[model samples]
Every structure is written in C-alpha cells, then in structure tokens.
Target chain A: MRELEERIKNDGQVLGEDVLKVDNFLNHQVDPQLMYHMGEEFHRLFQDKKITKILTVESSGIAPAVMAGLIFQVPVVFARKHKSLTLKNDLYTAKVYSFTKKVSNEISISKKFLSSDDHVLIIDDFLANGQAVQGLMEIIDAADATLEGVGIVIEKTFQKGRQLLDENGVEVQSLARIKAFENGQVVFVDEDQD
Target chain B: MRELEERIKNDGQVLGEDVLKVDNFLNHQVDPQLMYHMGEEFHRLFQDKKITKILTVESSGIAPAVMAGLIFQVPVVFARKHKSLTLKNDLYTAKVYSFTKKVSNEISISKKFLSSDDHVLIIDDFLANGQAVQGLMEIIDAADATLEGVGIVIEKTFQKGRQLLDENGVEVQSLARIKAFENGQVVFVDEDQD
Candidate 1:
C-alpha cells in the first residue's frame, strides 16, 4: 500500500480538484509488477473469506483483477460494458452511471459464470463514484451469490463512494487512499487513520 | 502450448464457421492460472527478442498482455478504443475495422509510452482477422518503435489473418492454432505443422 501511495505521488497526474489520472502506471500503461504486489496485498487481506470468484468491470480492472485471481486461485469474471440499451436474456445485467462520462452504460455477466454457491470478491482500479462496484454487486445478487468483500487499487476518500459502501456495511479494502488533490498535488489519507 | 491446445479442445465453443467463443477461460470468465502459464510460454517464445514493452488492445486483450508483461519484466500498454472520431494530439492513433461488428473503431496509445528506442511485443487474446494487431502495428510505426514480434493466445489457421502476417514477414507465435471447426468441433493445426 505504501508503495502504491508513493507511486501515485510520483507518477500520477492530477487534473483539477477531483481527477487523478493514473494512466502512466495503473490503467493505460500498466506496471504488472505493481499489479502483482497489489494482488498479494488483497490476498493477505481477504485470505479467509472463502472467495470462490473475483468480479470486475473490463479494460482497466482486468490487470489487477486477474492478478488477484492468480493469487486467490479463483476464476475472474469481467463484466462486459455496452453503450447500447439492447438487452440479452442469458446474462445478469445492471446499469451504471458514470459521472465523468455523463452517460449510463449497461454492464452484464453471463448467468452461467456465477451461481448461488459462489462467494464473490469485487475488484477495480479506482473507487470514486462507486457506480461500477455497485453494478457488479447487483449482478452478484441476481445470481444469488454471496458478496464476500471489495478490493480496490486506489480509492478517493473525499468522494461519496467510500461513504456509500460504509453505509451499506460492505467490507472494503483499498491499497492507496487519496484524501484529496490540492494545487496539483495528491493528499493521501494516513494509514493509521485508514 | 499443449495445455492451451487441450483447453481449447475441451472448453472452446465453435459458433458457426469462424467464431470460436472462449469466454469460459480466455476472455469473459478468465482462468488466471492458465493466463500465467500462457505468459510463461510467451516469455519462452520471445525471450530472445529483447522486448522492452508489451502491447495489446483493450477489454479482451488485457489479461494475457499483462501476464506476459509480468513475466517479461516490462511494461504493458493497452490501446484504448473509441467509438467516436475525435482525435487528440498527444496520442498515436489507428483505425481498425471490425468485420463481425461492422464498425470501424479507432485505437490510440499515448505518445509517452512508446518511442523509437522501444522494442515492442504485441500480445492478444485471439488473432482471427488481424485487424487489431495491424492497428497496433500502425501505432508502433507512427511512434517509430520496433515491433519485435507478436504473441497470440489463439490463432485461426483457416483465416486470412495468418496469411497476412506471413506475407508481411512478421514473426508470430500462437499458443493454440485452430485449423478448422468441423461440425462444432475444433480441429487444431498439428504442432509439428505449426
């Protein structure tokens, strides 16, 4: 977590007050070594949860989710996103509203992949608006699967996402918690307070 | 490679003549251990190329590319796809036509990630039409980067993709090569012939 926090400070780009672009290492251009370490940390945090599957949204989430799946030795399912409103029958689907993009995208997972017997862990690159995580949770619920916990690579604490998860009593762990962005610099929440 | 071929024979679904749906393990629902092994095989194949970076298209290609990045101890850059025709100055972009979808999507990579000094190895989930690989190669050419080779998880030998790459004289290594789909059964090109 410390390494991730440091990497954010060193390489991450701050856009205005609320945006932190980690395209350099976390999203667009990925450092797989860092992803591996984050996966190890997630395993150490949720080793006893009996997680049967790892779920995430596609593209950015695949790197860390797959790495965590490797450590957890469980299958990783990435929900496919579609701009179209056309629906399918054999899939569990949910609508996620992205505040940045100002559009609602439909995310879906095949019904064959998840079931009531599975315990699922949700993983993603960033937890800002919590829309993506909430969507995955809905898919899991539709499958009658148990939600074990949520693992995040980077979290924006100043946003309402963490607060919403806390209100819902969902167990959440993030490798790096960004308190805020001030004058083109990142302010991290102290691990002691976290 | 043998294990990968076996997995395809066991789990891959042949939909119609050319479509091989591998969502059970390769794309939608990923087996990370299998991905790790695929990464190892890629490293074994391209170890002598002196690859400084790994490249792939987003969504489906992220898994194998990131895994190969981990094993190769290099960075992986996934080209972002856009449905719109918007262009940016700081990115190297290419237009890719998806025959199945009947749409032309634009893929772009940040200029900062690739350079003339970089030796790139392109990895992807499937190489059926080779449009995505050709797009990445175009981006690499735009950046003046040297493409060492390509690593494909599955290749369709009956498709024109293999012929195009062969004509271009690009070194390509595929873990599993499908010769044809006979009555919904996958027929792999013999390893000796490959």
Candidate 2:
C-alpha cells in the first residue's frame, strides 16, 4: 500500500477536482510488478475469507483481478459491459452509470459461471461514485452467491462511495485511499486509518 | 501450448461457423493458473525480442497482456475503446472494425506511454480478422515504436487474419490454431504444421 501511495504521488496526474488520471502506471499503462504486489497484498488481506472466485467488471479491473486470482488460486470472472455474441442469454444483469463516460451500460455475468455455492470477491481499479462496485455486488446477489469482500486498487475517500458500500455492509479494502485533491495535488488518507 | 490446445478442445464452445467461445477459461471466467502459464509461454517465445512493453486493446485483451507483462517484467499499455475524461487529448488513434459487434470503434493510446525507443509486443485474446491487431499496429506506427511481434491466444486459421499479418511481414505466434468448425465440432490445425 505504501508503494502504491508513492507511485500515485510520483506518477499520478490530477486533472480537476474529481478526476485522478493514473494512466502512467495504474490503468492505461500498467506496472506489472506493482500490480502483482497489490495482488499479493489483496491475497494477504482476504486469505481467510474462503473466496472461491474473484469478480470484476471489464477493462481496467481485469489486470489486478486476474493477478489477485493468481495469488488466491481462484477463478476470475469479469462481467462484460456490452452483450456480445459469445455471452450466453442466461445472465445476472445490472445497470451501472459511468461518471467519466457519462453513460449507463448494462453489465452482465453468465449464470453458468457463478452460483450460490461460490464465495466472491469483487475487484476494480478506481472506486469513485461506487456505481460499478454496487453493480457487481448486485450481480453477485442475483447469482445467490456469498459476497466475501471488495478489493479496490485506488479509492477516493472524499467521495460518497465508501459510505455507500459501508451502508450496504460490504467490507472494502483499498491499497491507496485519496483523502482529497487540491490545487493539482493529491492528499492520501493516513496509513493507520486504512 | 499443448495445455492451451487441450483447454480449447475441452472447454471451448463452437457456435455456428465463426465464433469459438472460450469464456469458460480464457475470457469471461478465467483460470488464472492456466492464464499465467500462457503468459510464461509468451515470455518464452518472445524473450529474445527485447520487448520493452506489451500492448493490447481494452476489455478482453487486458488479462493476457498484463499477464505477459508480469512474466516479461515490463510495462503493459492498453488502448482505450472509447474516449473518456480520464484519457488525455494527446493520443495516437486508429479505427478498427469489430466483426462481433458489427461496428467500428476508435482505439486510442496516450502518447506518453509509447515511444520510438520502445519495442512492443502485441497480445490479445483472439485474432479473427486481425482488425484489432492491425489497429494496434497502426498506433505503434504512429508513435514510431518498434513492433517486435504479436502473441495471440487463439487464431482462426480458416479466417484471413493470419494471411493479413503475414502479408504485412508481422511475426505472429498463436497458442491454439483452429482449422475449422464442422457440425459444431472444433477442429484445430495440426500442431506440427504451426
């Protein structure tokens, strides 16, 4: 977590108050060494949760989720953003609004992949408004699966996402928590607080 | 490669004549163990290429690309399918047609990630018509970066994708090569032929 916090400080770009662009190392262009370390940290945090599967949405979340799956030695399932020909008809579906893209898209997972017997851990890159994480949780709930916990790479604590997930009783762990972004600078939450 | 071919034969689904779905292990619901093995195989194949970065498009391609980056101990850069607020304006863009969705989308990579000094290895899930790979190659060309080669998980030999890349003198390596799909049964190209 300290390494991630430092990487954010060194390489992250804050473009306005709400958008923190980590394309240099976190999202677009990724540092796989740092990524696997984050995965190891996630595995260390949730090793005893009996997680059978790791779940995440498409695009950015796939890297860390798959890496975590490698460490946890579980299958990783990613919900697709669009309905593709390869995706089956019987699916657990939920609608998620992307604040960055300003669009609401339907995210779905095949019913054959998830079941009531599975314990799921949801992972993602950035948790801003919590829309994507909430959507994944809905899919997990629809599958009648157990929601073990959520692992986030970077979280914006100033946003209401943490409160929303807390209200839903979802245990969340994030490597880097941004307390605030002021004057093109990022303020991180105290290490002890996390 | 033998394990990958076996996985396709066992878990892959043949839909009609064109689509071969490996969502059970390759894309949607992934086997991390198998996925990382593929990454190791890729590293073995392209180890001498001096690849500085691994590149792919978003959504499905992120997993394998990131996995390869882990083994290669280099950075992985994925082109965004849509222009989002987090993506910068300075980008190398290319148009690609998707046969699955029957639509063309502009894929863009931030100019900051790639440079002429970098040697890139393109990694992806499927190489059907080679449109996405071509789009990525175009981005690499725009940046004046050196494209070392391409690593594909599955390549439909019946399609013209291989020929297209061949005509362009692009080196390609695919783990599973499908010869045909006859009567909902998948037939793979002889391993010796590859």
Candidate 3:
C-alpha cells in the first residue's frame, strides 16, 4: 500500500479539483509489479473472509481483479458492459451510472458464473461516485450471494464514494486514498489506512 | 499447453459455425489458477526474448497481459478501448476493427509508456482475424518500437488470424490451437505448434 501511495504521489496527475489521473501505473498504462503488490495486500486484508469469487467490471478493474484472483486462487467474474456474442444468454444484469463518462450503462454477469453460495470480493481501479461498486453489488445480490468486501486501488474520498458504500454496509479497502486536491497538488489520506 | 487445450475442449462452447465461447474460464468468468499457469507457459515460451514491456488492448486482453507482465516483472501497458480521465494527452493510437462487434474502434496507449528502446510482447485472449493484434502491432510500429512476439491464450487457426500474423511475420504462440468443429466437437490442430 505504501508503494501504491508513493507511486500515486510521484506519478498521478491532478486535473483541477475533481479528477486524479493515475494512467502511469493504475489504469491505462499499468505497472504490473506494483499491481501484484497491491493485489497481494488486498488478499492479505481479506484473507479472513470466506471469498469464493472475485467480481469486477470491464476495462480498468480486470487487471487488479485478475491479480487478486490469482493470489486467492479463486474464480473471477467480470460484468460485461454489453451483450457480446461470446457470453451466454443467461445473465444477471444491473444498471450503473458513470460519473466520469456521464452515461448510464448496463453491466451484466453470466448467471452460470455466480450463484447463491458465493462470497464475493469486488475490485476496481477507481472509486469516485461509487456507482460501479453499487452496480457490482447489485449483481452479487441478484445472484443471491454474499458481499464480502470491496477492494479498490485508488479511492477519491472527497467525492463521498466511501460514505455511500459505508451506508450500504459494505467494507471497503483502498490502497491509495486521496483526501483532496489543492491547486493541482494531491492530498492523500492517513497511511494507517493502507 | 495440454491443460489449456483440455480446458478449451471441456468448457469452450461452439456457437453455430462462427463463434466459440470460452466465457466459462477465459472471458466472462476467469479461472485464475489456470490463467496463472497459462501466464507461466507464456513466460516459458518467450523466455529467450528481451521483453521490457507487455502490451494488449483493454477489457478481456488485460488479464492475460497483466499476468504475463507479472511473470516478466515488467510493465504492462494496455490500450484503452475508451479514453478515461486517467489517460495522458501524449499517446500512440491505432484503429482496430472488431469482427464480433462489427465496428472499427480506436485503441490508444500513452507515449510515455512504450519507447523505441523497449521490446514489447503483445498478448491477447482470442485471435480470430487478428484485427486487435494487428492494431496493436500498428501501435508498436507507430512508436518505432521493437516487437518481440505475440502470446495468445487461444487461437482459432481455422480463421484468418494466424494467416494475417504470419503474413506480417509476427511470431505467435498460442496455448490452444483450434483446427475445426466436427459435428459440434472441437478439433485441435497439430500439437506440434504448442
């Protein structure tokens, strides 16, 4: 977690007050070494929980989720943004609003992948408005599964994403927590959270 | 390699004559244990190459690429299907045609990630017509970088993907090579390729 926080401080770009760009390591251009370390940390944090599966959305979350799944040696189920021909017909779908994209999109997971006995751990790159997290939780709920926790690589706490998940009674763990941005400088939360 | 071929034969679905669905373990729901083994196999295949980076497109291709990157202890730069706030301004972009989606979408990678000095290994989940791999090769060409080879989890040799990559003189190593479907059964090509 310290490595991630340090990387964010050194490489992350602050676009005004609302956006923090971490393409150098987290999202677009990934640092696989750092990514695996973060995944190991997530596994260490959630080792006590009975996690049968790992859940995440497409694009950004897949890498970290894959790493987490590898560490836990569990199956990972990602909700597709669209109906691809490769996916089966039976699915559990949920509607999610993207605060970053400014578009409401539907995300779904094949019903065959998830079921009533699963204890799921949701992972993603960024947690802003927490809409994606809510959507994943809905899919898990639809499968009659238990939500173990949510693991995020980077979290923007100023956006109140954590508050929303907290109100929903979801335990969230983030590698790097951004308290806020001031005059293009990033302000990170306490290191103890890591 | 035999394990991967076995997984494909067991879990992979043949949809009519056009699509092969391996969502049970490859795309929709990922088996991290098998995925890590596949990554290890890629590591063994490309062990001689001096790869400084692992490159692939976002979403499905991301998992295997990340796994391979972890194996090499190098950076993994995934091309973005849709630009996010995390992406930087300086980028190397290429147009990719998706046969499944039947659309031409552009994938971009930040210029800061890949350099002419870096040797890249392109990795992907499925290779049908090689459009995604072709587009990634174009990105490598645009950056004036060196391409070590390509590592694919599964390759449908019955399609034109291998032919296209062969024509381009790009070395491709696929874990499982599907020759054809005979009466709803999957037939693999010569095992010598593995």
Candidate 4:
C-alpha cells in the first residue's frame, strides 16, 4: 500500500478539484509489478473470506482482478461494458452511470459464470462515485451470489463512493486513498486517519 | 503449448464454423494461472527481442499483457477503445473494425507512453482477422516505436490474421493454433507442421 501511494504521488496527475488521472501507471499504462503487489495485498486482506470467484468490469479492472485471481487461485469474470454479438444469452446485467463520461452503460456478465454457490470479490481500478461497484453488486444480487468484498487500486476518500460502500456494510480495501487534490497535487489520506 | 491446446479442446466452445468462444479462460472468465503460464511462454519466445514495453488493446488483452509485462519486467500500455473525458491531448489514434461485432472503434494511445526508443511487443487474447493488432501497430508506427513481435494466446491458422502478419514480415508466436473446428471439436495445427 505504501508503494502504491508513493507511485501515485510520483506519477499520478491531478487535473481539477476531484479528478486524479493515473493513466500513466495504474490504468492506461500499467505497472504489472504494482498490480502483482496489489493482488498479493488483496489476497492477504481477504484470505479469511470464502471467495469462490473474483468479479470486475472490463478494461481497467481485468489486470488487477486477473492478478488477484492468480494469487487467490480462483477464476475472474469481467463484466463486459459493450455487449458483443456473441454475448446474448442468460446474462446478469446492470446499469452503471459514469460521472466522468456522463453516460449510462449496461454492464453484463454471463449467467453461466455466476451462481448462488459462488462467493464473489469485486476488484476495480478506481472507486469514485461507486456507480460501477454498485452495478457489479446488482449483478451479484441477480445471480444470488454472496458479495465477499471489494478491492480497489486507488480510492477517492473524499468522494461518496467509500461512504456508500460503508453504508452497505461491504468490506472494502484500497491501496491508495486520496484525501483531496490541492494545487495540482495529490494529497493522500494519512495511515492513522484511515 | 500442449496445456493450452488441451484447455482449448476441453473448455473452448465452437459456436459456429469459425467462432471459438474461449470466454471460460482466456477472455471473460479468466484463469490467472493459465495466463501466467502464457506469459512465461511469451517471454520464452520473445526474450531476445529487447522488449521495453508491451502493447495490447483493452479489456481482454489486459490480463495476458500484464502477465507478460511482469515476466519481462517492462511497462504495459493498453490502447483505449473509448476515450474518457480526461484523455484529451497528444494522441495517436487508429480505427479498428471488429469483424465479429460488425463495428468500428477508434482506439487511441497517449504520446506520453510510447516513443521511438522503446521496443514494443503486442500481446492479445485472440488473433483472427488481425484488425486489433493492426490498429495497435498503427499506433506504434505513429509513435515511431519499434514493434519486435506479437504474442497471441490463441490463433486460428485458417483465418487471414496470421497470413496478414506473415505478409507484413512480423514475428508471431501463438500458444494455441487451431487448424479448424470440426463437429464442435477443435483441431489444433500440428506442431510439426507449424
């Protein structure tokens, strides 16, 4: 977590009041070693839980989720943002509104992949408004699967996302928690404060 | 390679004459151990290429690309299919046509990540029509980066993708090469023939 926080401070770009762009390392251009470490951290965080499967959204979440899947020795299923031509049967779908893009996209997973017997841990890159996590939770509810926990690479603590997840009583772990952005710099939440 | 071939024959679904659905492991529901092995295989195949960066498209490609990045100890950059709000500057763009989905997506990569000095290896989940790889190659060309080779998890030898790469004089290494799908069975390209 210290490594991730340091990486964010060194490489993360602060655009405006709330936007923290980690395209340099975490999202667009990925640091696989960092991802691997995050995976190990997630595994350590949720090793006590009975996690049968790891779920995440497509694109950004796949790397960390896959790495976590490797550490956990479980299968990772990523919800497709765009419905492909072949993906048209027994799907568990949920609508996720992206505050940044200002668009509502339907995220879906094959029903064949998830069921009541599976305990799911959701992994994602950024946890901002918690819309994506909520959508995945909805899909998990639809499949009658148990939501084990949520693992995030970078979390904006000042945002409503963490509060929302806390209200839902969902166990959450994030490597880097941003307190705010000031003068084009990222201010991380102190360890004691967390 | 034999392990990958066996996995394809067992879990891979033959939807039609050409479509081989590997959503169980390689794409949607990913097995990270398998991905790790594939990454090791790719490293073994292209270790001498002096790869500085690994390139791939988002979503499905992230898993394998990150795994290979970890093995090779390099950075992995994924081309963004959908441009987010913050991604507005110094961009290299390419249009990719998805034959299966019957759609064209403009993929972009930031100028900050790639450069002429970097040697790139493109990794992907599947190689069929080679549109995605071609699109990535275009971006690499725009940046004046050197493309060392391509590493594919699964390649349909009958498809035009392999031939296209061959014609372009690009080195390609596919872990599992399928000759054809006959009666819902995957027939791999013989090792001797390859």
Candidate 5:
C-alpha cells in the first residue's frame, strides 16, 4: 500500500479538480511488477475469505483482478462493458452511471458464470461514485452469490463512494485513499487500510 | 500447449457452424489457472523477442494480456473501446468493425502510454476477422512502435484472420486453432500454430 501511495504521489497527474490521471502506471499502462505486488496485497487481505472467484469490469480493472486472481488461485469473471452478441436470454444486468464518463451504461454477467454457491471478490482500478462497484454487487445479488468484499487500487475519499458502501455494510478496502488533490499535490488518508 | 488444447476440447462449446465458445475458461468466466498456463505458453513462444510491453484491446482481451504481461514482466496497455471525458483529447485512435456485433467502434489508446521505443506483443482472446488486431497495430504504428509478435489464445482457423496476418508478414502463434466446429465438437488444427 505504501508503494502504491508513493507511486500515486510521484507519478499521478492532477488534471483538474476531480481527475487524477495515474494512467501511466495504474490503469491504461500497467506496471506488472507493481501489479503483482498489489495482487499479493489483495490476496493477503482476503486470505481467509471463501473467495471462489474475483469479479471486475472490463478494460482497466481486469489487470489487477487477473493479478489478484493469480495470487489467490481463483478464477476471474470480468463483466463485459462492450455489448454482447452471443448472450443467452438469462442474464444478471445492472445499470451503472460512470461519474468520470458522465454517462450511464449497462453492465451484465451471464447467469451461468455466477450462482448461489459462489463467493465473489470485486475489484476495480478506482472507486469514485461507486457506480461500477454497485453494479458488480447487483450482479452478485442477482446470482444469489455472497459478496465477499471489495478491493480497490485508489479511492477518492472525498467522494460519497466510501460513505455509501459503509452505510450499506459492504466491506471495502482501498490501497490509497485520496484526501484531496488541492494545489497539485495528492494528500492521503494516512490510515493503514489493510 | 497440451494443457490448453485439453481445456478447449473439454470445456469449449461449439455454438454453430464456426463459432466456438470457451467462456468457461477463456472469455466470459476465465479460469485463472488455465489462463496462467496460456500466459506461460505465450511467454515460451515470444521469449526471445524481448517484448517490452503487451498491447491488447479491452473487454475480453484485457485478462489474457494482463496474464501474459505478468508472466513476461512487462507493462500491459489496453486499447479503450469507449472514449470517456477523462480521455477525450489524449489518444491515438482507430476504428474496428466487430464481426460478431456487426458494428464499427472506436478503439483508442492514450498517446502518453505508448512510444516509438517500445516493442509490443499484441495479445487477444480470439482472432476471427483480424480487424481488431489491425486496429491495434494501427495504434502501435501511430506511436511509431513495432509489433514484436501477436499471441492469441484461440484462433478460428476457418476464418480469414490467419491468412490476413500471414499476408501482412506478422508472426502469429495461437495456443489452440479451431479447424472446424461440427457435431458439437471443436476441432483443433493439425499442430500448435507457429
């Protein structure tokens, strides 16, 4: 977590009041070495949980999820953001509003992949409005599966995402929690959130 | 390669005349163990190329690319299929026509992530028409980087993907190539493709 926090402060670019671009290492272009470390951290956090599967949305989250899955020795089920053509009639669909994109998109997972017996660990690159996390939770709910916990790389603590999940009783852990991005410097929450 | 070949024969489902679905292990719900094995195979194939990075398009391809990147100790840069406000202006974009979805979508990579000095390995889940591969290659070209090679987990040999790549003189290696899909069986090519 210190490594991630350090990387964010050193390499993360603050574009505006809201956008913290860590694309150079976190999302768009991934540092696989750091990625493995992050995966190992997730594995340590969820070491005791019955995490049969790791779930994430496509594009950015898949990398960390794959890394964590490898460390945890569990399968990964990534929800496709792109529209599907071979989809059967049965699906667990949820509409998620991306606060970053400022648009809403429907994310779904096939019913066949998840079920009542499985416990899923949800992962993502960033946690902002918590829409993507909520959508993944919805899919898990629809499948009658247990929501094991949520793992995030970077979290915006100023946002309502953490507060919302806290009120809902979902166990959420973020590697680096941003207190503020004022004056072109990132301030951390300073709490060890393992 | 035998492990991957066995996974295909065991879990892969034939949809119709030509469509083979390996969602049980490859795409929809990925088996991380099998995916790791596939990554090992890809690493074994492209070991001598000195692959600086792994390039892939998003959604289904992200997982395999991440696995491969982890195995090879490189970064993974995925082409974003949907453009967002956060990535409006800083991108090297290309258009790709999805044969399955039957629509053209813009796939873009942040220009900051790729550069001329990089040697990339383009990895994907399936290579059907090879349009997506061409789109990714075009983005790499825009960056003035070179494609070290292309590694696909499964390639439909009956499709035009292999021929087009061979015509372009790009080296390709697919773990399992589907020669035919008939009578609910997914047939493998004569050998592990080189």
Candidate 6:
C-alpha cells in the first residue's frame, strides 16, 4: 500500500477536482510487478475467506483481478460491459452509472459461471461512487453466491463509495485510500487515522 | 501449445462456421492456471525478441497480456476502445472494424507510455481477421516503436488473419491454429504438415 501511495504521488496526474488519472501505471499502462505485489497483498488479506472465484467488470479491473486470481488460484470471471455477440443470452444483469463517463451501461455475467455454491470476491481499479461494485454485487446476489469481500486497488475516501458499501454490509479493502485532491495534489488517508 | 490445443478441444464451443467461443476458459470465465501456462509458453516463444513492453487491446486481451507481462517482467499497455474521461487528449489513435461486433471503434493509446526506444510484443485472445492487431500496430508505428512480434492464443486459419499479418511481414505465433470448423467440430492445422 505504501508503494502504491508513493507511486501515485510520483506519477499520478490529477485533473480538475474529481478525476485522478493513474493511466501511467494503474489502468491503461500497467506495472505488472506492482500488480503482482497488490495481488499478494490481497491474497494475504483474504486468504481465509474461502473465495472460490474472483469477479470484476471489463477493461481496467481485469488486470488486478487476473493478478489476484493467479495468486489465489481461483477462476476469474469478468462481467462484460456490453452485450457482445459471443456472450450468452442467459445472464445475470445489472445497470451501473459511471460518474466519470457520465453514462450508464448494463453489466452482465453468464448464469453458468456463478452459482450458489461459489464464493465471490469483487476487485476493481478505482472505487468512486461505488456504482460498479454495487452492480457486480447484484450479479453475485442474483446467483445466490456468497460475497466474500471486495478488494480495491485505489479508493477515493472523500466520496460516498465506502459508506454505500458499508451500509450494504459488504466487507471492503483498498490498498490506497485518497482523502482529498488538494490543489490538484493527492492527500492520502494517514494510517494512524484508520 | 499442446496443452492449450487440448484445452480448446475440450472446453471450446463452435457456434457456427465463424464463431469459436472459448469464453469458458479464455475470456469471460478464465482459468488462471491455464492462463499462466499460456503466458509461459508465450515467454518461451518470444524470449529472444528483447521485448520491452507487452501491448494489447482492452477487455478479453488483458488477461493473457497481463499474465505474459508478469513472466516477461515488463509493463503492459492496452489501447482503450473508447475515449474515456480518464484518457488523455494526447493519444495515438486508429480506427478498427470489429468483425464480431460489426462496428468500427477508435482505439487509442496515450503517447506517454510508448516510445521509439521500446520494443513491443502484441498479444491477443483470438486473431480472426487481424483488425485489432493491425490497429495496435498502427499505434506502435505512430510512436515509432519497434514491434518484436505478435502472439495469439488462437488463430483461425480458415480466416485471413494469418495471411494479412504475413503479407505485412509481421511475425506471428499462435498457440492453437484452427484449420476449420466442420459440423460444430474444430479441426486444427497439423503443425507437422507446415
């Protein structure tokens, strides 16, 4: 987590007020070494949760989820953002609004993938309004699967995402928690404060 | 490669004459163990290419690309299919026609990630018509970066993907090569015959 925070300070670009662009190393262009370390940390955090599958949404979240899946030795299932021709008809679907993109898209997972016997851990790159995670949780709930916990690479604590997940009784863990973006600079939550 | 071929034969679904769905293990619901092995095989094939970075498109390609990035000890850069709020304005863009989706999308990569000094290895889930890989090659060309080669998990020989890359003098390596799909059964190209 310290490494991630330091990397964010070194390379992360903050545009305007709410957008923290970590495309240099976190999302678009990824540091696989750092990704492996994040996976190890997540595995250490949730090793005892009996997680049978790791779930995430398409695009940015796939890197971390796949890395975590490798470390956890579990199957990784990603919900598609669009209804592709390859995707099956029988799916568990949910609608998610992206505050960053200012759009809502339907995310879905094949019904054959998730079942009541599976335990799911949702992973993602950034957690802002918590819409994406909530959508993923809905799929898990629809499948009657057990929600083990959520692992986030970077979280914006100033937003209501944490509170929303907390209200839903979903256990959440994030490597880097941003307190605020002061003057286009990141202010991380101090360890002692937590 | 043999292991990959076996897995495809066992789990892959032939939906018609064109679509061969391997989403069960390669895309939607992924087997991390198998993914790691595929990465290892790719590493073995491109070990001497001096690849400085691994490049691919978003969504399904991220899983194998990230896995190979881990083994190769390099950064992985994925082209964003859509222009998002997080993506920067300074980008190398290309238009690609998706044979699957029947739509043309602009894929872009931030100019900051790739450079002339970098040697890139492009990886993808499936190579049908090679449009996606061609789009990625355009980005690499725009940056004046060196493309070492392209690694594909599955290549449909019945299609013109291999011939397209070959005509461009681009080196390609595929784990499994499908000769044809007859009566919902996949027939792989005999390597010894080649």
Which is the leading candidate under TM-score?
A: 1
Tens-digit per-residue lDDT, B1-194, candidate 3: 89988888888889888688888888889888887888899999999999999998877888888888889988888888753344446878777888887888888888888899989999999889999998899889988999999999888898899999998888999988888887887888875455
Writing each residue's lDDT as its tens digit, candidate 3 over A139-174 gives: 888889999999998898988789999998889999
TM-score of chain B of each: 0.96, 0.94, 0.93, 0.95, 0.93, 0.94
Docking class for model 4 is: high
Q: What 10-residue stretch in candidate 2 chain A is worst by lDDT?
A: A82-91
State the fnat of model 2.
0.97
- Worst 10-residue lDDT window, candidate 6 chain B: B80-89
For candidate 3, what is the total of clashing residue pairs? 0
At residue B9, give the lDDT of candidate 2. 79
Task: Quote each prediction's TM-score.
Answer: 0.97, 0.94, 0.93, 0.95, 0.93, 0.95
Give the share of true interchain contacts found in each model. 0.97, 0.97, 0.93, 0.96, 0.88, 0.90
Candidate 1 per-residue lDDT, tens place, B27-106, comes to 79999999999999999999988999999999889999999999999999999999855558899999999988899999
lDDT of 2 at B62: 84
DockQ-based class of model 1: high
Order of candidate numbers by lDDT, starting with the best: 1, 4, 6, 2, 3, 5
* Candidate 6, pairs of clashing residues: none
- Clashes found in each candidate (C-alpha, N, C closer than 3 A): 0, 0, 0, 0, 0, 0
Each model's DockQ score:
0.95, 0.84, 0.81, 0.89, 0.74, 0.84
Off by over 4 Å in 5: A82-88, A191-194, B83-89, B191-194
Q: Give interface RMSD (Å), model 6.
A: 0.8
User: lDDT tens digits, residues B29-56, model 4?
Assistant: 9999999999999999998889999999
Task: Give the Å error, residue B130, model 1.
Answer: 1.2
Report the first chain's TM-score for all candidates. 0.97, 0.94, 0.93, 0.94, 0.94, 0.94
Each model's lDDT = 0.93, 0.90, 0.86, 0.91, 0.86, 0.91
lDDT of 4 by residue, A1-194 (tens): 89988888888888878898889887799999989999999999999999999999988899889999999999999999853345556888888998998888889999999999999999999999999999999999988999999999999998899999999999999888888888998888885564
Model 1: per-residue lDDT, tens digit, A1-194? 88998899899999977989999997899999999999999999999899999999988999999999999999999999998556588899999999988999999999999999999999999999899999998998899999999999999998889999889899999998888887899988894474
Candidate 3 lDDT score at position A34: 82
